[model samples]
Target: MNLKQEMSHSPQTVILHQHPLTVHTCHTVVVGSGAASLNAADTLHRMGQTDIALVTDGMNRGTSRNTGSDKQTYYKQSTSFTDADSPLKMARTLFNGGAMHGDIALVEAALSLKSFYNLVGIGVPFPHDTYGQYVGYQTDHDENSRASSVGPLTSRYMTEKLEAQVRRNGTSLFDRHLVIGIITTPGENGDPAATGLLTINMEAIDDTGYGLTLFNCRNIIYGTGGPASIYHRSVFPKSQAGATGIALEAGAKAHNLTEWQYGIASTKFRWNLSGTYQQVIPRYVSTNANGGDETEFLEDFFQEPTPLLDAIFLKGYQWPFDSRKLLENGSSLVDLLIYIETQVKGRRVFMDFRRNPRCADEQGTLNFDLLGETARQYLTNSQALLPTPIERLKKMNPLAIDLYRTHGIDLEQEYLEIDVCAQHQNGGLAGNHWWESNVKHFFPVGEASGTLGIYRPGGSALNATQVGSYRAAEYICHRYTQPPTTTDTFLAQAEHLVQHRLKLLKNLVVNPEQPSNVLAFQQELQRLMSRSGAFIRSRPALAETLHRFQDELARFPNQIHICHLKELPAVFRVYDMLIAQIACLSAMVAYDERQGDSRGSYLIDHEEGTHRISHQGMHFAFSLDRDFRDQVCETFVKLDPPADSPDTKQTTDAAVAAAKVTHQWVKVRPIPEYTTWFENVWADFRDQKIFDEKRG
Candidate 1:
């Protein structure tokens, strides 16, 4: 299905604070252009809600469009004819991952096949067997073979297909608009309800005052993704800077903010070095900053070649860095070694695929017989037990090699630089089964929603995004079908907030005397977060970083200086990043203070911890918080003045000092046990009582 380029619509213009502002009014405003947001708009339009718009900072920029692995998997129900599966069983599998809400899991599991078929119907070429069965394979944290993929660019294809459908539907596409704030009004129950959005048009920044724009709509489907730019070492694409902070400031509670996935990823091309990349057992080499003094570092710790080679092969299956795998010289040891070499010793690490890993006792000979049972049998079955890693990779999956060439990285000629980089956040803004936040009318779908728990199946994120987007759109079209309030009413509700933002924009626009500090601020914040928040966490470091980030956020526009109007978007990105950092750091601090031990994808460095791993005079002591895994941590913050708490006075102290920041740990919700009686369910479905918030 080929389609022409989509253009942005001309919105009605209005003057605010002496600057011409564009006003776009729609029934539903989807605040991103990723696969999830596009699916939501497409589904909404198909369901008879024609007044839809998609607003994005960039139409072609996001993790879904730019990032993937060796074989990007999409998890769904078992589709093969011989496999036995049901929605209830899949729900139990998802719920078994501690701290996940059972109802959301059930919804995702029940809708998994529907969502998968939707992509299939839109021409995503998910491969199937000659017998007309969609074959599947097992992924991490999975008991069933429920994962499938279409090569290294599965997500890219999904995004393109969904986007073509949305463009053909004539949905309004507002590209290059940065969402700075979410406008809310008082609900009937006295809680804040989102009514609109405040955005900055990137193209008009030079001629207008910050390119200020307003989106007054009845509903907002926020799919802007997770906070990827907060980390200095991340596998997320360079363009994926998330707007989660603004949503948190708009009274959306965040869940499980501390749980994140980290893995060894190639730094040069920013791709996950999983699947066949590790299965071939590439040599782990380190060198000085100038690309000299090359050394194979893994041999320094391992006395033999068999165990080390097996660990490298297992790294393909166990890709994510799991703390539990550290005790037995497991695959996670590979990550720790890489971390020490790059971060502590200040050396560059690379994977030499051209040569197989060699040990002192091996005498430069490849030994296939010494491999472990799992690695040996897998390689033997795939006919990949060749002479070198490159030969094995080429024989097994040539598409993996081709993927690198497309990005200008020739694996056959050069080595690939790698780092233990942050990959995915298992948590984000809180939402119910319908993906609606506690703040009424606000929905956070895709990676922006805190749907996944501490641990999840590898490709479950893709499934969750489809299910959540469809569910949110269904709810919007049926239950929340009312049009937005009048433009005058929207302005009345959002005037003070708009005026305050304009004042800040005016101050930033006039500050040319000071040199531009956007890059400095961004680098500093990313470094602070990567140091204190990524994979390794310490109580003192988290607390101190929280204080520092809070101070930085409070001093936002005052300390930030921009020379040209074009720098406004970058300046605002720093502002949003700072807020996100403060919230994430605050959550880390609270988790540490609550006696939360290391669990999931991170390790809490404690001297008297229960577990310890040592190699070459480097010792790591971490406590496994097995009990903490059963509970979910929730965070709610107010960096700006709260509308509900009008009597609370603002102060000059850091945002944390003047704001209300709260964190609480609660028991996870158990899986719902529903009656399977047919007649009773049919009556409820006929009456439309299932859509009621109370029942959900």
Candidate 2:
């Protein structure tokens, strides 16, 4: 359909076309329709708010499957007699995963058992034992029986249930809609409160052209998923498109943007290529042309003490060097070395299912006992996959069956592949504990908010989405005393912004360039990041890459071409590229300034006796742009030991002594203080005229 025709036929599409010109009466508008957004809408309804509308790209297939299965398993495991885990314990485990940087109150709320029960009440079908006890299973990063899954498709299932609930409550949904920007008003404290949203109805508009729409809402919730798409081969759907970029462009202060996780699944051969098929391989075993080996690269490199290893094993089946312990004990250096070695060896690593007996059994249970039953019914009734039972998948993959049959590997296997995935980006629109962002009336939840702190434990994602949604809705219901009118000034500003974006889009369409010009530069950028920024970072490489990036930014305009008037697609893609650069640069700075040995994902040297060696030290170094120039800074910290205990000093001393390290804090001439250094850096960057040049 033509853009105008499509917009005229659909209510949501029409809203977008008229947004710039129409003065919308403000109501509560949720920007995503995931679990978080649905929960938020539900909360608003419960709190007696009727004028609520949810805007989302569409019902996300991957997320819905994951949530549905996760919810089912969570309920089953929580009520199982074999599982005696408590919410308090779950909360503590989550806090440790985040290195104690996460908010305690938020963690506690997320772990509440009632949250799972609430999901069951909302039409989530959970697994149950013969006695009606809920069945549960273990998953990544979760210490207790917190995860319950029908299959890998739990997310999709949960999303469907939640969507149904939202629909039943009469909460309006704008499907296939993309938010372009946010409207905010200056509040009493100089904070910009979100007043409404500008969106494009992608489904309604023709593929060739689409117009902008305005959505006036009292509160906005951002459950826009993660920025993994910024990387070429993320597990998430490409449809995600990093819409959060638009929010960031609209003046959102995103934190932890630098903390994106690097999982082991990335294909080493095709590291820099987009659309390359990548597998989420287990990390327990390393395979060469010879065969599978049982050596744990991570554990061996860290030279993890038996005590720590024992503690990790006891916690659950999957604990890959507790980041909390590494941070406290100053032994992250060792961890980094191992990861670097594994990557350099050119061998694909798989989680050694042989060591962990529970791995196969768990897979079987998920496949047969849970999803198997459903598949059987479907196949019998509909002749799907032309198979009577899908359980035959176990035999199709020899590695899986061999581990199960020959080795007697059971579902509760002791070891599994545990690698970091770009799970979530916690930094997006700055918000308070109540979910209100810097924008007075705007709120963010899920991966779109930075309130979750640096690291999130498994299952916490579900918790945060549900809790944040409910909390934000509750706050808005009480704080929004009256409906907001579309004032003349607001309409004028919206019109101007819309016109500016339209003009930019038009310019791009009329001036198309060869694809190779843009593709070559993109490939070069990806190659630079893969070698210098992936897995490990060093001083010289970082400095060199930043210099290269500066040059690229200068030439980007000349090298790239745009052939569309809808700037949203091109703008979003560019933003992703920029964010990727920012993430890499941040990692480089952190690695460069950090003097101690590398730990976790960051490694110092590839092999033993190399020029680089992971050092053990009390302080970690990081660099940030303050005034615009990069400045290195250090913060004294301990990772393994709890920060609050009296024995912290003794623990730090012992850890340092074990590593045979000593340091003398000497004051160099004219040492810059933190504030002054930041100011100077910020000023330098601003004066460099880079931002202006890029904008132009």
Best prediction by lDDT: 1
Candidate 2 lDDT score at position 511: 45
Candidate 2 on 186-243: residue-level lDDT in tens? 7676866677776666644433335456775566777776554444423344345455
How does model 2 score by TM-score?
0.62
Q: Flag regions of model 1 displaced more than 4 Å.
A: 1-10, 360-365, 509-515, 640-659
Residue-by-residue lDDT tens digits, candidate 1, 1-696 = 323232223367877767777887888899887888989989998999888788999989988999999999999999887779989889988888778988899999999999999999999999998897889999999888999999899989999999989888877778989998899998968878999999998888865656888998899999999988999999999889999888987889999888889999988789999999999888999999999999989888777788788889988988988888887768888888898899889999999888878762255446888788998898899998787888999998899999999999999999999999999888999998999998999999999996998889989999988999999999998889888888889988878778767766665534567678788879988988988898878888898888887766665566766778888778777777777777788887888887777777888888988888777787889877554767888989876542333333332321222345788898888778876888988998888778888977
Model 1 residue 5 CA deviation in Å: 14
Predictions in order: lDDT: 0.85, 0.47
